[model samples]
Target chain A: MNYIKAFAPATVANVACGFDIFGFAIQEPGDTVEIRRRDEPGIVIADITGDEGRLPRSAEKNAVTVVMLHLLKHLGRTDFGCEVVLHKNMPLGSGMGSSAASAVAGVVALNELLGSPLSRKDLLPFAMEGERIASGSAHADNVGPSLLGGFVVIRSYTPLDIFSVPVPEDLYCTLVHPDIEINTKDARYILRNEVSLKNTIAQMGNVAGLVTGLMKSDYELISRSMVDVIIEPVRSILIPSFNEVKKAAIDNGALGCSISGSGPSMFALSRGIENATKAGEAMVRTFAEVGIDATMHLSGINDGGARVLESY
Target chain B: MNYIKAFAPATVANVACGFDIFGFAIQEPGDTVEIRRRDEPGIVIADITGDEGRLPRSAEKNAVTVVMLHLLKHLGRTDFGCEVVLHKNMPLGSGMGSSAASAVAGVVALNELLGSPLSRKDLLPFAMEGERIASGSAHADNVGPSLLGGFVVIRSYTPLDIFSVPVPEDLYCTLVHPDIEINTKDARYILRNEVSLKNTIAQMGNVAGLVTGLMKSDYELISRSMVDVIIEPVRSILIPSFNEVKKAAIDNGALGCSISGSGPSMFALSRGIENATKAGEAMVRTFAEVGIDATMHLSGINDGGARVLESY
Candidate 1:
């Protein structure tokens, strides 16, 4: 095959008290990339769509091409060339892992076109490099889930030990993305450098509970544990009607609701798809009450992360 | 039964990265309590052994009787009285949840004597009252495990939500108590009130990993995740040869080793009893090198927490 097309799912990070540790992928609102091999010696971003000309077009600055370059360099194929086209189906700066999806899709498509040299796990660092260029930090919570699929815990980042945890069969996510934009870097910076030890302990307890709840498929435990004591209290201010939206979701049968990642976007987990839809409508209605437009995506936890779509 | 005797196992709290959340029960070196109905209108500590006259004789101040009184009050039977005897088989202030064992044993024995008014789970807060009297905080990590058995996560303390997690069949604990004494209160006070957000995220990541590891029985994940970036670096100073002892255990095949609660005592988790024993021996020898004698208790995770021993 001279070319390949791939798709990668968007992700939600900092799932409640998990701050930089927890993330999970959703089936819809993802990114797609198409890659074609070239005889010339440099990668190029041939085209882009859905980003409204805001994303950088320069190959070095673009999330998709940067990831492709990293993978090619690692493979000792920097001498080779590729032409990339990114279809950004998800909104950028929505706290929905848009950049992560594009980066993962680019590398997966290129990897598939080049005879599939690396496994999906091997493509993670390349995707993370894409994140580092898009944001100041190379956080894996978004990239890990988008690349690996399912609910993932970035256990440690130094050596990059990340693994996927089990997702409940009936569990569904109601993702509500309000139109307002909150810069990830700014949201992260506003957080205090030092957190109270008491709050930290409480957060750790919830993290433990969340992980255990997911593994055991205990909805009550998950509901009780999905509390973010440290980050949400600060970051929620950046989002419009955050508390009311969360309350609406919770009141409408969401197991737990919180800011999806940095802000402007929120997610609610529910037991079944029907409950998830109801929760999503409640959240959207609450957002509308404050004269803010929002979009909702109802999806199960995506178990297949980035994968080849088709070959030409 | 006019009188009832019960035994409660000792526990290791803060099991590595868990701080105030994670704990598990050990099968040996526990405490026993015997309660007999009396005509007096108040709880009384009739006799005590193995305490070396160090424990409080006043029923209100004693860990065992204090827990019993709390239960009696909760049962609305404050007018009833009981004669209590506690056998403190484990060393106090050794970070082995000695007080928690006494507290749990007392409540369990009295409950059995009074026709088992509450489930083992219901006795947690009363047991924590004993912890509060012994130390300054009503933390449930110790008491939760001592009362419930097996590995447990005290998800929250406000409403007292504590639940047991699964343990691998072959998992064993090597608990090494050094000669030095470290007061839990003093150890806790020495810690800083605030922790860097970076360190807190790292800690939360490890907590998530450890819980997932235990549930999935992924020993490697457990080993990698059993880290305490926030607590251990500060608390370990109170334990002589702490670093060397930890290295010895790790080198000798322990899955992971850390201060067992606020320590002078340490615990190492391993896949099998053989590895646990070797790890224990290495830790003991390391302590001996520092001119501090140490005692080791190697046992599997206790599935039965507190139970009636005899009735007359």
Candidate 2:
């Protein structure tokens, strides 16, 4: 097969108390990449769509091409070449891991076009390199789930140990994306360097609780554990009507609600699609009341992360 | 029946990364309480043993009597009376939750003598009240596991949410108690009020990993997650040759090792009794090399927290 296309879903990171370690993939609003063999000895971006010229046009600067370059270098296939077209289905800078999807799709499709030399897990570091280029730091919380699917927990980062946790089958997410942008770098910079040991203990307790609740399929435990005492208090100030939107989601039957990643996007978890849809509508309506136009997506947890779409 | 006797096992709190929130009960080295009906209208401590007279004699000051009084008051049976005999099977301030076992034993025996009016879980608050008197603050990490058995996670303290997590049947603990003391209050006071956010994130990550490791029975994950970046560094300094002892435990195939609660006592977890015993001997030898005598207790995870020993 000389031509291949792949899709990678978006992810929500920092799931409440699990800052910098927890994340999960969603099914819709993802990115796609189509790769074709080329006679040239280097990778090139042939076309880009849906980014409105906001994403970098240079192949070296884009996450998709960066991932492909890393994967090719690692496989010692530097003489190989590919033409790439990235279709951005998710909004940029929405705190919904848009860049991660693009990077995952690129590497997945390129690996397939190269006759499938690398396993899906083997491609994680290349995708993480793409993340390091997009964000200032190489955090696996987003890209891990986008590549591995389901709920991902990064136990440690030095050796890059990542694993997928069991998520309840009925768990659904309501994502409300307000038409605003918050740069990931700036959002990370605004956080305080130090936190009270008391709050730190509280955060750890909640992290354990959330993971246990997910593993045990305890909805009430999840609801109680879905609290962020450390990051949300600081980052929420940047988002408009953050508290009001969260309250609305909770009132509309969300198990819990918080800023999705950095800002301008909020996610609420519920037991079923009905409650998730209701929470999404409530969150959108709350944003509208604050004079902010917002879009909502309701999706179940995506068990299959990046996948090959078509190959010929 | 006019008399009842009960036993509550010792516990190791903090469990490396889960400071102030995680703990599990052990099978031996626990306290016992014997309760006998009396005609008087107030609780009294009639006898004490194994504490070398270090424990308080005053009913208001002792954890066992204090727990009995609280349980009696909660049940509106303040008009009733009981005579208590306390047995201290563990060392004081050894960080093995000595007081929690005593309190749990008292409540369990008293409740049985009162015809078991309250469930085992319902006795947690009174046990916590005993903790509040023994230590400066009421923390459920110790008492929760001692009362409920197995591994316990205190997700929140405000409404007192506590739950037991699934523990691997083969999981064994090696507890080394040095012949020294470090008051829980003093150890807590020595810790810094604030910690770096970076370390806090690491702590939360490990907490998630440890809880997930226990629930899924993943031994390697448990080893990786049994790290205390926030508390162990500071508290270990108070214990002599702490690093050497921990290294000894790890070198002998122990999964992980750290200060059990506040310090002077260290605990190591292993896959089976053989490894646990080897780890325990190594830790004891290391302490002896530093000229500090230490005693070791090796036991499996106690799924039964507190139980009746005799009733007549």
Candidate 3:
């Protein structure tokens, strides 16, 4: 039943204070997964378009291949065979969950091609396994939004419970990606080993506010709750004009603004589409003024992640 | 124009994870205040009951008198004169906002006695000032809940911003007070200065779950989200049968259970009134089985803090 046709969606990761534990997919930015059945029983990955010369074809180091391999092994079909071609539709290592997008797209497409051997919920751990291939640890923030869409909060590490929050009708998101790169690993290493209790409490309050705001669908509360006192202070040092652009975006009437993930990219939220567009423009102008070329996206809240683009 | 009438309601302090920074008032277990116009401009205090002579009467030590003094000074009325009587409603230091209840009752009563000179919002600071007289520092976890009904969260220290969260319709709270006293200061002093980064991140995740749960009105999510990794470990040591009672209440169908405020008191939540009553009984039985007598409250979520019982 391995149809030669399949598709997977793209995602935006590092949602403000949520860091690696939250992410969501965008409608426009997505990957296509077209697979075909073969007599061989191992996963073979081919990186087309979006990934130029940097991606590996080997199944071992590849995130998607690892997950597919695990899936196949679990099904007692280690000899099962399929070749997954990932049209890397999103940028790689751009703080936008580019690699995760690839992994998710591959697994989702393969699963669909195999008549959905695993449920989407059952597929998350495999996706997370793919994430650990690069980040050295599994982080759910990006995987969740990529899979479930909308605002998400992770409640535990050992159990890894993910909670979806109600998105406000007026909610709009703006993403600004500068033409530069900062590896998440380097950024993570730079963080201090310890934080004071006072700062911890402050950060927790902000985190609580952010989650509550999303669930209540209170755009104003969501905007006010976006303050981050922990990772942002240290992480922002890697990105130029982070503060200036944030200030300009808010001044231009954005509800809240912060680094999108580990960035050369940043994000802002607004109560309406018009405000989101304007905020995006404000960010673009601010980043350009600081000598960083940037592009902005004014998008609405996404309610679905990766899905079958044309399922039977 | 002194109406000689005052009132203050019960408050839920240290609400959930906000610990020492959040609280809100209920219409029950409230205190009543009566003030009389005096020939002397300075404040005079008299007629305190329900404290059984274990309370202070000195104007400097009395929470009500201190608040009246602050209010008079704030209003630029040094000649302000009044005689006061207080009805001590809620039990003192029972982790039910006893201190804040008194402070709020005194200030609310004073506000009315002075011909409603200040609105409720304007009166919060002075009531918080009264709390400072006893706690040695200004903290609103007790005062905020005593003044405003429903749920609350506090985010900052300087200038003090309080966030009011929407309570779920099916929300029910059950409280169990053991016959013992464990001071807030003692609970605070037992806590370690440093927390593990891993634990802090876990705490952040749980907080996110909690806030979202409340906003979504997801009782199951709220129940699952009610966990403490930072302060509970240190504070739970002070309360006997803390774990036993918690296990019993939850096993008997409580949504979630945790120590109330500091110590010597604990509370559980449920989705329905019947379940709340069952939770209360379970809490009482658990404590009694461990040879500790306890008073329990099976109650609904209070939305309004205080009202004029009888205005003339």
The candidate scoring highest on lDDT is 2
Query: Can you write out model 3's per-residue Cα lDDT over B71-164, one digit (the tens) per residue?
Result: 9898998887878777886667677767777777778777776778888767778888876776566777667766766777776666576677
Cα lDDT tens digits, model 2, B1-312, are: 889989999999999999889999999989999988989889889999999998999999898898888888888998998889999999888899999999999999999998899999999999999888999888898899999999999998988888889988889999999998999999999999999999998898899889889889999999999999999999999999999999999999999999998878999999999999999999999999979999999999999899999999
Q: Per-candidate TM vs. native? A: 0.99, 0.99, 0.94
User: Per-residue lDDT for A101 in model 3?
Assistant: 71
lDDT string, candidate 2, A53-133, tens digits: 888878889888988998898999999988999999989999999988999999889989888898988888889898899
Clash numbers, per candidate: 0, 0, 13
| Per-residue error (Å), model 1, residue A119 | 1.1
Clashes of 1: 0
Off by over 4 Å in 3: A4-14, B1-7, B21-28
Residue by residue across A1-312, what tens digits does model 1's lDDT show?
888989999899999898889999999989999888889988898899999999988998887897888888888988888888889998888999988899989988988988889888998899999888887899998999998999999989998999989988999998999998888889888999999998998999899888888888999999999999999999998987888989999999999999988867899999999999999999999999989999999999999888888898
Query: DockQ scores for all the models shown?
Result: 0.93, 0.92, 0.59
Which regions of candidate 1 deviate over 4 angstroms? none
lDDT comparing candidate 1 with the true structure: 0.91
